[model samples]
Target: MRLYTIETGFFKLDGGAMFGVVPKSLWQRTNPADERNLCTWTNRLLLIEDGNQLILVDTAIGDKQDEKFFSHYFLHGDATLDGSLAKYGFHRDDITDVILTHLHFDHCGGAIKRDGERLLPAFKNARFWSNEKHWEWAINPNPREKASFLRDNILPIQESGQLHFIKDGEPFSPNIDIRYAYGHTESMMLPQICYQGKTILYMADLLPSVGHIPLPYVMGYDVRPLTTMEERQHYWQEIVDNEYILFLEHDPINACCTLQHTEKGVRLKETFRLEDMFG
Candidate 1:
């Protein structure tokens, strides 16, 4: 099996929203904000090449949105989804599966593209994977999350007849297991991949960055903040016990990290690029 880090690009979000109740004095020390208090974050995706199946986890915000819509996020970076795939000698058509952890615009917007007046699946030949629960929640989003779940980023997969769901505890592949967390959004799926003699968990929103490892650092964007805290407590132990390598999705700098048990609680032990571990 082979793995590659697909960086789509970076965008900015209000630091206060990302860190929830954590004070600026603390989070800012790690993820320093710009003049407008917006912190830069990377939309990092994961690509898995096992045998003939090429699976991609999450597609960053695409270039389909209008300039007015994009101005708010301040999307800026050199990386792109297609460019990143080409870097690994692949193309959009090469992907067999696209596992959308959730339907938030930043995470799944690139799954579809604007072609004339029609919206189409970006990966023409891939099966778009999203759970039944999350699928329903996103399509009929509540007021709190409606803005993040853009119809342009979703709806097209199901319309294209390429949508599929993997139940909790189900295996997406021989080496990949699906774990569901309801804290961030309803039934947000996190892929637990066993690779290179280590288990790597895709920390999709569940733990956006190493700075969020602390129990109280839950994001204000989460629908259920208390649920998020409980979920974090449950997973932090497993992360420490199994010594899992956490593949961060939105961390601006770090790509991966391992956890260590400290007197306070589980904290980041070491950080490195994914290649450093596999190469």
Candidate 2:
């Protein structure tokens, strides 16, 4: 099995929103804010190459939104899905599965693309995987998260007849298992992979960055903040016990890290690039 960190691009978000109730003074030390109180974050995705299947974790924000819509988030960086895939000698067609962690625009936007005047599946041959509950929640989004679940990024896969869903607690691949959490969004599936003699958990929005290692540092966008605290407590314990790497999706600078017990509970131990671990 092989894993590649696919860099789609970087965008900005209000640091306060990303840090939840945590005060800007505290979070700014870790994720410094700009004049606009926005912090740049990486739209990092994961590509899993196991045997004959090439599964992509989350598709980063695609380039389909109009300039007015994109003006809100300052998108930067030269890395793109096509360029990253080509570097690995593959293309969108080579992806057999596109596992959306959730239907948030940043997480699933690249799953679809603009084709002439219509929206369509970006990966023509890939079976887009999103849990049934998440699919529904995204489609009928609540007022708070409605802005983030753009219909253009979703709807296309189902319309194209390429959408699929895995049962909760089900295994996604031989080496990967699904763990469901409701704090970030209903049925947010975090992929637990047994790779290189260690367990790695995709941090998704449940834990967006190493700075979010603190249990109370939940994102304000989460529908259930209290549930997030409980989930983080349990997840951090397991992370420390198993010495698992937390694969961050939005951390601008760091890619992966392990945790250890701290005076304040479990906390980030070491940060490293993905390739450094196995190289």
Candidate 3:
């Protein structure tokens, strides 16, 4: 099996929102904010190539939104979904499966695209994979998360007849296993993979960056902040004990990292690019 890091580009978000209760004095040291108090973050996706299967983990925010809608996020960067795929000699049409971690706009927006007046599945030939629980929650989103779960970014896969759900205890692929966390959003699916004699856990919002390694650095966007803390406690220890590599989705600089049992609980042991490990 081979894994490739697909960088869709970067966008900015209020640093305060990204790092829940953590003070700017603390988080700014690591994720320094711009004059507007917004911190730039990368929308990094993962691609898996195994035998006859070519699977994409997540799609970053797409270009379908109006300029007024995008003005708030300040999306900037040269990399794009199609460009990143072509970098690995692959294309959206080459993807056989698309595993959505959650239906948040920034994560799943690229799954669909704007074609004239119709919104459609961006990967027409691929089966879009999402859990049943998340699927239901996103379609009928609560007020707290309604903005993040845009109907344009979702619903199209189901309408296109290409949506599939991963059942509990059911394996999606021989080398991949689905791990769920409810704090970030209902049943957010984290893809854990066994590759190159090491395990890589895709940290989708559960742990956005190395700066969020501390126990209290949960995102303000999380619906259940306390549950997020609990989930982090469990995963942090497990990652350290088993020496697992964490594949970060929104970290601006680091694509992957490892944790260790430090004097101050689990802390970042090392940070490096995914290509540094597999390329």
lDDT, candidates in the order shown = 0.94, 0.91, 0.93
Error of 1 at 277 (Å): 0.8
lDDT, candidate 1, 1-279, per-residue tens: 999999988999999999999999999988999899999999999999999999999998888999999999999989988899999999999999999999999899989989999999999999999998999999999999999999888888899999998876679989999998998999999999999899999999999998899999999999999999999999999999999999999999999999999999889899999999889
In model 1, the worst 10-residue window by lDDT is 164-173
lDDT of 1: 0.94
Stretches of candidate 2 off by over 4 Å are none
Candidate 2 has a TM-score of 0.98
lDDT of 3 by residue, 1-279 (tens): 899999988999999999998999999999999999999999999999989999999899988999998999999999988999999899899999999999999999999989999999999889999989999999999999999999988888899999999997787888999999999999999999999999999999999999999989999999999999999999888999999999999999999999998778889899998888877
TM-score to native of every candidate shown: 0.99, 0.98, 0.99
Query: Deviation in angstroms for 162 in model 1?
Result: 0.9
Error of 1 at 231 (Å): 0.9
